[model samples]
Target: MVVSARITNFLAYSSLTVSRVSHLGNGSLRYQWLLCRNTSLLQLRSKIQTVVPSITSNVSVPKENIPTADALVRPDLEGLYEDIREGLTNTQPELRQIAQYYFNGEGKAIRPVITMCMARAINYHLDQNAPGVIQKQKKIAQIAEMIHTASLVHDDVIDVADSRRSRPSVNILWGQKKSIIAGDFILAMASGMLARLQNQQVIILLSQVLADLVQGEFMQLGARENKDERFAHYSEKTFKKTASLIAYSCQAVSVLSGADSTLQSIAFQYGRQLGMAFQLVDDLLDFIATSAQVGKPVAADLRLGLATAPVLFAAQKFSELNPLIMRRFQEPGDAETAFRLVLRSDGLQRTKELARQYCNDAVTQVAQLTPSPYQQALVTLAHQLLHRMK
Candidate 1:
């Protein structure tokens, strides 16, 4: 029942966002209702002031109990890359290089680290005295990273992005066709690795991530003309593309660890919330960070004609953005004008505030577990995500 409720809450938000676009003009009561229904920025501001304190009050875990961010990824950092490389060894040399290109130990492997952290923490939660990560759990971590990297490769092709992580993208080096093949190849290898896990339930759970990735890309290719519906559209896309993998990956590990349905739901909820927050931060970084800082071009979303959280939030204050969003900033200076408007408005700050809520919610969900270093690391990591520059 709890699982059903959580899943419903997750989908309800999506449904609200993608609802039919009302044709009523701006000043009508019905129009106002639709606009405010998804919690307008004004409402969010009030909620943030009141809700954050209440939420933080529920977090009983102490600061001293949490582990450092370094402690979270350091243990498995070296072995994770090696294992991922080993997974790629059976493929052809060129495919192997393209598939393994982004695994160069530079970027922070946040997904796998979160997976392993959840695995160990859940392991400890189930057995307070037995707090070690099992072999199968490690495989899940590797699979998560592989799936993530594969998505990045495909995304670069779709976005026609030339750079990633301060290096030339796979699409740039290998061309779009081979870059796509490379992405597919990495996914195939990850699938094979998943099959060896031999857990039908876990396999099904992780497999859904592949479908979500495709669905998200489809959502990105289109735009919502209705201002009321755009934020919901963005949220849904963010979940399908970014959050589903983390949510399902965390849930898969929970299933592997023999967690009860309730515990598994908690893991999924944590990952769902954290994944949304992570992407929100990424969207914010696109607006505020430099090309060198984020290792990718700034304003990439705007250039791609996509309206992310920041742009969506900024739209509320600037009606000029409505047509720009509808047409996807295709006009000369549309992207530039929209970018300036977003900065002038409170979009960046509101986006940050919303992300902080999701991050706090992640911390709250993980705090339900039995207190342990691994659990504490998960909590600490959630907080640290807000401050990340890249």
Candidate 2:
């Protein structure tokens, strides 16, 4: 979804990094795969070359992964996600089954993990003795993840997608109507968890994220005609769809941390900037990554009649793209021509530059937090997001 890159002076030279985005929903993985004993970096290098042949690799992946919440948050943190289905335990048998499908195996857990990390970081900033696990904030993390998974479930139906995480899509396994119900069930469960938190501010913050998801989907249904305006439209839609949850979730955790409004605003900014960067990288990858790599169709955006950052950038060099985007590629051969133009143009590179800028901005905003292992981990996360591959 939404996330960035930049190293701070306090961070070790060897920092956490994510080299791939292996899957989207259940079993979503990032970077740590290279550290798996069975998987080698050399193998990873060859795989990256094979999967994202369009983009030339530049940033070097570390042979050894630095310690971060990706590894640390497991086992003990498992409870945060493991039994979320229990929230719907009282539902009808089939309803519970569809709702709990993805919850069976956690995805990357990016939103919730970052939420937990932010809570401690902000607590340390306020001079509190932060606990290893704060119940309410952890609940917020769970809610964030629940909201994310729910959106993806609905997204599959909207995209008419057949697979997720290399597995049959919820809509594929169970018809679209059932998939829609399952997605709603997930959101309903998330809402229940949110209300139980009893923090009005938290409720309000996450509630906005819910609204943004719908608004983003609406935005996705069309594209702007003006070249410059299209980029703005795309970026704004990206913020609402992918970044909103991450940004607000971070802000929600900051609120729970009892941070002052100023600190809370900064925390929200950190998440927002990173979320923007994360989606930009994803847009670039659509042109670069294969269907086998990212677990979704390559150029899925184009197939959906959407114009992302890369296509917008390409339009500057090849004015012909403007008409295709406006028509939603309705004309025959439009999609193919646009694809070739994007590859030959510097669109991906330019888009990557913009993504990195946002990543850098994310780093700058989080730097305000008092230095803590949690804060450092957050910083390392932003840095690693730039190079995310899966």
Q: Quick one: best TM-score, which candidate?
A: 2
Q: Candidate 1: which stretches are off by over 4 Å?
A: 1-66, 69-73, 128-133
What digit string (tens of lDDT, one per residue) describes model 1 on residues 1-390?
Answer: 011232334343333434311000000011122223433333333333332222123223446645664576577555788788887878789988888888887768888888878887888899723333377877888899899888888888876665676577788788989999998988999999999989999999999989888887787787664887777667677788888888898999898888999999999988988888788777777666544566655566666678887777778888899999999988877876776677677777666766666777788799899988888888887877777776
Candidates in order have lDDT scores of 0.73, 0.70
Worst 10 residues of 1 by lDDT: 21-30
In TM-score terms, candidate 1 sits at 0.82
* Candidate 2 lDDT for residue 270: 80
lDDT of 2 by residue, 336-359 (tens): 677777766767777676666676
Candidate 2 residue runs with Cα over 4 Å from true position: 1-66, 130-133
lDDT for residue 60 in candidate 2, whole number 0-100: 33
For candidate 2, list the clashing residue pairs, or say none.
3-274, 4-382, 5-382, 5-383, 6-383, 19-389, 20-389, 20-390, 21-389, 21-390
